[model samples]
Target: MNMAAVKLQTSVVSQAGKHTASVIFLHGSGDTGPGLRRWVYDVLGQNLAFENIRVIYPTAPARPYTPMRGAQSHVWFDRHKISQDCPEHLESIDSMCENLSAIVQEEIRAGIPKHRMLIGGFSMGGAMALHLVCRYHQDVAGIFALSSFLNKDSVVYQAVEDASQCPPLPELLQCHGTADELVFHRWGEETNSLLKKAGLNTSFHSIPDLNHQLCRQELELLRSWILKKLSL
Candidate 1:
């Protein structure tokens, strides 16, 4: 694995009135940073009444996605199905955590407070969000994982166990489509159960009659959650 810095393209949407919070959006695999621009306008823009809120969309580095051949896309780390007991998987988890920590630190240096920052993404991006929030060193306002799965089962289990000896975890919102074929709905169930069992504050919603993509209602629900989280 390369420890080289991954270049991230960013787009910021500023609120004209009173600012409340800052949301950092990470896009899914194969999608550019600007791909989530419409989500800012449609979901956050229209829903958030506060003028001070800002939305930051960051693009992941384009890289080869292993296991799934003939594919290259934006990914936080190389995807591999290591043995269930392998410690190698934890190494990948740590790499992602460090990458996200750097990004969060950058956001804080740019004026976003740790308490007012929200991290979220869709698909692979969503998986990154979930992993970061669980293992992050600092506190964030909220976390949203949409159409995504937990990175790996064992790592999450260990994180949960460790969290028991520390302070509370941040609030988490997970949304998944029951009909999703790519990332099966079972992933959502497993993640939800794991997080809940860990005693973290979490909310899970399954969209009916939907597939791998997010539906209009799901987007609306996300918008609402953002507003409530930010108190906008």
Candidate 2:
């Protein structure tokens, strides 16, 4: 968990001209950057076509996750089970946040303001995304978490509080299914409540009759949300 931050590989599709904005979407534990790019590309094409926006899907570092039975997977963090919590969770999250910070810095150095970039992810990736926004030194255009959990710490809470003092902490959108068998619903509630307590702008959507996977409704909402954020 203390490994130096490695530059994450990304599958990028961008406009040939100057990019008005950029988005980096992190995939779930077992998913690859290229795979997520296809999903995100199709979703955006269905509703959003801002030709100046650059969309990227970044690969996670390979780790032999215990839940995967020592099988290496591109995961943002290590956890034995979706809902299981442990002391090492903090370390895992910090490492991932550092890695994400590196990605955000790259965008900033490319003449894109951090506030003009969006970062988000699904499942474990979602958890990492949320954590990165909260823990990092700066904010972005926005962030969304799908089926993710919040970190447990006064330190993280303090960071969110401090970030909010700067005004306009990256907008937070948390969506989770009520019947999500893996991460469960309560964690989503906890995340929402935590952000609210820190005075950060955060919203939570509890999808009814949904499971571990994204449904059409969630997809539509995600598309709309991203479009709205980008337009800002």
Choose the strongest candidate by TM-score.
2
Candidate 2 scores a C-alpha RMSD against the true structure in Å of 2.7
TM-score of each model, in listed order: 0.84, 0.85
Best by lDDT: 2
Candidate 2 residues 1-232, lDDT tens each?
4645688898887755677788877899889888776665575554223566787788988887878787988888877455434444566667777787887778878878877887888887777777677777446888888887754543556778887777867788889999887456787788779888887788899999787666667767876787788774
Q: In angstroms, how far off is 144's CA in candidate 1?
A: 0.9
- What lDDT is reached at residue 176 by model 2? 92
- Give the Å error, residue 2, model 1: 1.0
Query: How far is 89's C-alpha from truth in model 2 (Å)?
Result: 2.9
Backbone Cα, N, C clashes tallied per candidate:
3, 0
Candidate 1 lDDT at 100 equals 65
